[model samples]
Target: MQKNSFLTLSVAVLLVFSLQVSAQDAQPEAGVTPSSPFHIFDRFGDWARLNLLTFNQVRKAEIKAEIAEERLAELKAVVLEGASEDVVNQAESLSTAVAEEVETDVSRLDEEGRNIADLTDKFNQLSLRHQAVIEEILEKAPAESREALTKALEVSKRGLEKAGEVVLKQVEKGNLEKERAEKIAERTIEQLKKQVENRSEALKKITEELGEAPPELQERFNAKLQLLEKELVNVESNEQFKDLRERIREDLKATVEDAREFRKMHNVEDEDSDDILESISEDGAKVVERVEKILSKAKEKVAELERSVAQAQTNGKEIPARVSSLLDAAQKHLTEAVAAFEAKNFGRAYGQATSALQNAKNGNKFFEDEDSDEERDENVLEKIEEANKKIAEAERKVEEFKSKGGEVPAEALRVIEEAKKQVVLAKEALAKSDFALALRHAEFAKKVVEKIGALLERARKAVNSGTSNTLRVETKTEVKNEEVERPANTASSAARQPQVRQVKITAEGFLPRELEVKKGDTVVWTNATAKPSWPASAMLPTHDVYPEKGGCIASAFDACKGLAEGESFKVQFNPIGAWKYHD
Candidate 1:
């Protein structure tokens, strides 16, 4: 009996409401014609209707609800015209409220608006219950997702609260402020949307992994979602309805497309939901087209990167890692390139044009090409070999310089300096058995041949710039902090002056581990490392040892244990001298 009565009344109410709406759509002045999309308003009447309602109060409220419903119908037409995202969200809200009103009024009509408070409380409790469920889920979330969930939950609550506020404010807000308040409501609705979308996205990911959800389960879930969304719109302010509806529609469309993609990729063969898969296939093509557009833009960026590389080289600058960009473009172009090649569509092609484009971009963009380390090793080996060749060449040049009768060629000096550096590095690398590296260092030394060319170039530059071949080395006043005892080895007062040096000596396995110095020209050392059986100090008692004191062993610090392992020692070589001492 109750079901039959309820059905009959529902049909009558829906009919009455439908006719009223049709009348309003035909006439704009009767109610607000929605200019914006998606407007479902949370009514202020519920707050006012909390009081117990007499029969007369009930009748008055019913009249008021019908009037509001009429206005809504008019607004529906307005919103459907071209409702923006903001408007769609708001319209849905108003629709939800309308639904709620019908549901409640069926139980007991309230045209007089006397007793809506209890009903409002009931719906509010439902909303709170839903929030509690969300909060519980958040509490159990893993650490990685907890932060995002917390932020989203807080924002969503705010959005709901703002929707409520906009509804309350509409009653009191003047015409001028109505526009401003509606804007606030629209933004609030958008925030709610973002929160829901993120939640749905995460849920979709989980569901995808689980394989096909049962048809019954999907339908149930969808039904519950629709209910929840309807409630959400009803709770939001009426002024925000248009914007709310628009946002919801757009979210729904995008969400469907996204879900379809997930289904296409992860669906089991012979999966359930033929309808779902069909929808996915259709929407996925559109999404792919959109992605292709992005790829096109990326290709252009790669081209521009190439141009930048060429420009940089013209100015002698290093290349950039548009390396990644070039690689991406090559991959993208290869899609079509391979197809074309496979079909023998010889479009003036040897390799894909994209490869050349990529190569062009790569030309100036200096990067570790795939085997860069191997190449570097090869370079090192080459440099070492060159250094050895140059050493022999320089020895011959040294004779040539001397044969020029006391004019040591500057070219010879420069080559000597370079060869000195190469020799030091080679010794270090050799100690490490980095033969490949050692060889490279040796090769660099041979490049000393180039220094002869640099010398003539410099001479030419000096002639061009009208500068002198020799530059002056000026002597400045020097201060001495350490005590200095001058010797008569220097006849001149100037030659006897001490020179201070801050030198970092790395004789890792050698004696006299480190040295500190001040202005002076002499040094002495006490034997510190090597054999424990020998009295170290006694072996070289007076410290008159020269670098050659121990047979080339002086230079071969690693072989002598002349330096001890894990023993740190330092010395003060103030009044600096060649100071060559050995133990």
Candidate 2:
């Protein structure tokens, strides 16, 4: 009797273990939608599988790509079956999340000093497939679902970018062959060409449908379609595959933005004017908040300048007359901004605040001494190192705060992200021996780190006080050499005397939209719109389109951060290629 009882217990234990394994491995059978009852089990399986491979980044990334593909399939299935808007959105969001996960995993592999070429190549192919699928779905999706699908499409494009970035990094490290890289670039360009073609065709169809529409509207549509066709021709004929890829990427981005704008412009009816007004009011409130934040930052900078001036005097160093004048102008603007803000004139306040910040930056620039190439290089290197240290410290503080149960504000997170971008720009600038620009980027990054420190402290205080509110603060300072020798200029002597050109960032976009300038020419973009704008080299967020590689993310042509209203950012075009930029 005892032997029989023991055997029974063992069998029961084996049965329970098998049940647990089956549950953990549960996956939806064929034709299951995200809305189905068994979908939760499918999600659990994905999560379990992902967690199981956490230690294997390459494999994890592969799994993530697969999961993303699955999500995309679910999205297509649900859309075809007329899922509810919420359900569709959920599926799209899941697809985005999984694609982003793949990106993150690949990044981790790169960071771990592992070989990422194969994984990146795999991801690149996956992204292309995803993009094609999303585009097809976009056509069949309902209007409500179109927006979410568009977002998913953008995310897939970013995945492609991420994969390309890895491939480029590996090539630079000599881990990837040039032939392979070129092939990848060619593939991406081909995909982009297809996208441009599709967009042009859609626009043409829309133009046809506007048979009896207003002449002005018809004219605009025709003009846009013609421009797209022209770009398509350029993409196909360009022999330089890399440049072709970038141009086509920009084409797709512009097409997407224009499509959204066109929809917004024509979708509304006379009855929606009230809703539009409400939206305008809400936007105005956000602008007010942004202006207030700028004002606070300007105030801090002006005060720091004041302290620096005092220190200069105490050290028996004569303060430059121009520096004093700029400081006074900054203070004057700050006072006016405060007054305007108090009077609820947010627009005026924003202008004044931006002017104050610019003046403060100008004053700070006076303190930076001119240096020879060697000195500049050394100084920039040191500064970049210092910036990295500060970033490390800030990251530690953030982790500690989180460990202590602190809820980091979204604004603080954004600041951290900006700080990282600045550091990257600094490093890129350093790589090209653009020491002044490098130092400027590094200094900006340092300032951002300081701002993060202050924000985290404020957050900590709020946590301790059992309050959820924290004051928002940000500061910006620019470093410029009043007179410095150009680095390795190959332009003619006459062209070596750099000329400054102006581009206005208006509500409609860059005023001139395009410009042709000789080498050693500087273009300054002033923000004329109410909102802040960031101007950078194209290929979007990475900004590494210039042949000269080294600027945050991709090239040294980035503004690093947003320029507030009434402020300006300047970049000197170098190396004589047809460069593209966007805000």
Candidate 3:
């Protein structure tokens, strides 16, 4: 009975150990899902080993393959032990797809690798041809070209060495996917081809460069050579003790070949311009793309400015008049840029867009540089005092004109009344401590007073037996430089204003040579002469008279660039003046 109990206990222990082993085997690894259609391996290292071993020829491939097979075996055991029938069916189809993808990627990588190897061989052959050519031509090449040619050869050699090192590192890492490896191979081949082509061109350039040995060209070549030599030395020193010596040996063979090819094509000129035309077309598209990007950036800046202005508004801070005007100008320029771009005038479009960007930047800078609200309020107070003083002085001048029994122009009285109204508005804004508004109103009031004082002086001059016709003054309210179509009814609109009047230029010089119109009226000058007529501001010694103070061809003051018979040039009488213009 004692012997039987010992055997039964031993059997029980063995059965428990087996059950524990089965339970552990049934459990899935971390990241392993028994029911899922797709598999995500527990570790990238395992996945990489499995994929890399198939393509790599190193001894490590055998070891990594064994480890990957064991891991897959464990995964299969777990799936078979725990996965339901439905999961097994789904995984079957998914596994097939994944297998097909792997096969395709592997095939693609093999094909690309073959292509790369072939190109590398071809390049090597070309390099040998070039080496022979370089040796043959170097003795005959001009002294001026030797330095440049030698430097180009060194640069090409160093670039090849560096590229080879990079390729070796990739091979050792062994983690790149099949697709990725294929792409890399293609890219390497492309780079090699371009490098070879460049070397050929460099060699050809020696001949051309020798034909024109200007001092500047020699200087530039010497500078570039120095830089290349320095870089080559640096590369040689850094890679000296590394295992890359053997690799460099192999690379030098190719380099020498490349150097030879460079000298071979010394006299061969380009035979076709297809590549040149293609390059130009590509460059043009790139330029247009860059311009469009600039336009987009400029627009964003303007929008940012607008947002800043809106924020200031929310805080009950008024935008300064000048700031507002600048913002308007920025917007105007941006619109013009868009129009110019649409018309395919990229040069003008870029200029206008850049201007808009700068203007918006300036506006933001102005806002940031502004004084604090309290300081601004104090400044506004001082401005009000100055404006009031100027208004008083202007009123005194007006009274003096009346005492002299001079005819006070109706426009003068109207401006004085407007000045008073602006002053009232300024005082109201000052009471509310709205400094920006107060300053704007106060400055405008001061401008009106100054304008009225000038009118009063002109009236005084009229009293000295000068013409008393209505004074037509053209003042610079805004700088208008944008090219836009004018409203067709501009003359009719000017006529509708009560304070505006008209003047005409007929077949004879000026209809009433010295006739005047009210301020803000339209002066329509028709070229009624049979010959082309130029109505321009008079330069003192030559023409002797001008319609306005700032009148010049640029300002469109008497601007008729020889209008043909029946053509007309219209000038808006904005400035207050007793002025004259002639053909």
**Evaluated with TM-score, which candidate comes out highest?**
2
Task: Give per-residue CA lDDT, model 3, range 333-384, as digits (tens).
Answer: 7998898678554534554665687668767764664687568778887887
Q: CA RMSD for every model? A: 33.3, 30.3, 34.0
Off by over 4 Å in 1: 1-298, 301-360, 364-398, 404-494, 498-547, 550-583
> Which run of 10 residues does model 1 get worst, by summed lDDT?
470-479
Model 2 worst lDDT run, 10 consecutive residues: 470-479
Which whole-number lDDT from 0 to 100 does residue 468 have in model 1?
28
* lDDT (CA) per prediction: 0.39, 0.61, 0.47
Please give, for residues 410-440, the per-residue lDDT of candidate 2 as tens digits.
4466566656766776776666554555676
lDDT of 1 by residue, 330-390 (tens): 5555554445334332221112332434333443233323435356456665666666666
Query: Whose lDDT is higher: candidate 1's or candidate 2's?
Result: 2
> Which residue runs does candidate 3 get wrong by more than 4 Å?
1-366, 414-441, 451-458, 464-514, 517-583
Give each model a TM-score: 0.19, 0.35, 0.25
Clashes of 3: 11
